[model samples]
Target: MLLKLDLTDSRPLHEQVAGAIRRAIAEGECAPGDRLPPARELSRALGVNANTVLRGLRALRDEGVLEFRRGRGVTVLAGADQRARLVDQAGALLAEATRLGYSRADLVELIRRLP
Candidate 1:
């Protein structure tokens, strides 16, 4: 769910963080059974309060998009296969990049994947 921030955007940092996490979940960038960073950590990273992270998480949980356990923390609801799901979802990204004249190397650099 975590991604780079858009320094130029007018959106609030917390909203951006929440949106990124939401998109990741929707697109399978974060898979079922995946665990999110703790609220304090995310807040520190995003330069926001822990309560902001908590609100975002609670909103997602209320939407049935994530499960938050009191002590164990937050985890994606496990069922979908991470690899296959991401592969399918990434097809659109690949095509869009091609349409925009981006090479695989350029995409790799821009995305800068964790692994």
Candidate 2:
């Protein structure tokens, strides 16, 4: 996978890593059931600490975009592209809402009130 990091980005390294992977998945750079490069390999390529890569991968797994299997390694989950896009959109919405002085509960309530 080709993971790109914007050195100028102010977000945490882990978040940038996750965003790169998420974009790759959304762009069809990888598909469902496709195994990801090992975290160490990714760290080496991205020039970040292995733990940082793992943290990003863990975040993806938590977002349901990737799955971790013993010995099988990390693989993209089915429907990951769509899910990743939705997750990204939700994140953007949350950030915007926060910037507007709204809390998480306010965002949730706003979403709930949507038709």
Local distance difference test scores for all models: 0.71, 0.95
Question: Against the true structure, what is each candidate's TM-score?
Answer: 0.57, 0.92
Model 2, position 36, has a per-residue lDDT of: 98
Q: Per-residue lDDT for 1-115 in model 1, tens only? A: 4556675877666556655676777676888888899989988887778897788777667656678888888987764344334543565587689889998788888888746
Q: Which candidate wins on TM-score?
A: 2
Predicted structure 2: lDDT: 0.95
lDDT of 1 at 93: 82
> Which pairs clash in model 1?
none
Model 2: residues >4 Å from true position, as ranges?
none
Residue 16 of model 2, lDDT score: 94
Per-residue lDDT of 1-115 in model 2, one digit per residue for the tens?
Answer: 7888999988999999999999899899999999999999999999999999999999999999999999999999999999988888888999999999999999999989999
